[model samples]
Target: MTVWDRPEPPARPVPLDRERIVAAAIALADEGGLEAVSLRKVAARLNAGPMRLYGYISAKQELFDLMTDEVYAEILPEERPCEWREALRVLAHRTRRAALRHEWLADLLGGRPSLGPNGLAVTEAKLAALHGLADIDTVLRAVETVSSYATGAIRREIASRRAERATGLSERDWQRASGAHVTRMLATGRFPALASAVHDGADVDAETTFATGLEWVLDAVAARLTRPPA
Candidate 1:
């Protein structure tokens, strides 16, 4: 076939862009966690030279930032709720869902400022939820508090799941956390609170635990907003 008759190499795969690069990286992260994602791997996934991605993403952190912004898209509700409480609740739950979908997200959540468009939008929605309901400082604190809780909760949940998978035992097992070490610690009777928690505490669902903690944090915020200014 002549040069003109050839397929033009399928238009060079539509020229890699930031969106495509982030997508490829996210796919790799989804399969094997953040540690598995690298510029070389993403380039291979896209069938392009590794240098090609550099034109769009200067560094690996930028790629991770982009991936995080993409996740913020999931955190924004389709139709925002009217009440501030509901709005905050929706945002928290959505963030948790996003983490579950991309478990590696737990590593980056709240790790750095998200300056991308989507990340800015998520922050806007969070602050807007209480636009006129409270003072700016209070609102900022509330949003930060919720975000911190979500970040920690998701990280802990992922760690728990990983530990469970590494060991054959379910989280309900008596020795899930440290196996024989924890069992032995409990046996010593040196720490009553720790022993009681390990023995008497009911096994609660992760989602329930997260929601319960979030509600408590929100309650504190609510009190701050409603109370007369000191």
Candidate 2:
């Protein structure tokens, strides 16, 4: 066909990249949940075919990894603390806050090794905070311990929040009033320590509980450190 008669090439498809793919996946997860995210759904969100996504992510798990790393960017501190303890504490809190914001993160936090750029940056920050405090082994152990606590805490917090939403009751109310079975069990005195804790323990908010537990973990780490934080 002559140049003038030739059909114009179809408009170029909107640019696609890892960022866009991950963003679409994250949006899907946020609206529904991780289970809601799929390559077809993400591709649909981007006005592309599912096969097109293969160029950016080979599998669903890879998409999840990208989403997790993207969230890690939010966990990176704006200004890292100078003190190692404060640095670790900040990282833990920021990670918790990030998980809270992206509730699906509870499902994926520490699920896999984070090798993405942003993820590595987070690890580097944590390691840098304890650069000279001890031998490499000890530092690695401290980081892993603190990270494990934070991951477990965040997951529990998310699970509790989900339970609260499902029951339309706060945790304490759910435990104390939602079930007569619990009350009967508590009164049986078979579990004296449990009963006492349930009846007499001060009811603290989730943030306070998390912070207190984190401090305890930090204290334990401090005890093991070869050099104390300045």
How do the residues 123-194 of candidate 1 rate in per-residue lDDT, one tens digit apiece?
A: 999999999987899899989998898889999998888777787678768355567897887788898898
lDDT of each: 0.84, 0.87
TM match of model 1 to true structure? 0.88
Q: List the residue pairs that clash in candidate 2.
A: none
Candidate 2 lDDT (Cα, 0 to 1): 0.87
TM-score of 2: 0.90
- Candidate 2's residue-wise lDDT over 1-230, tens digit each? 22212333333467787777889899999888899999999999999889877766667887887798899999998899999999999999999999888899999887767877788899999999999889898999999999999999999999998889888998778766846897788888899998888779998988999999999999998999956546
Shift of residue 105 alpha carbon in model 1, Å: 0.5
- The prediction achieving the highest lDDT against the true structure is 2
Candidate 2 lDDT score at position 200: 95
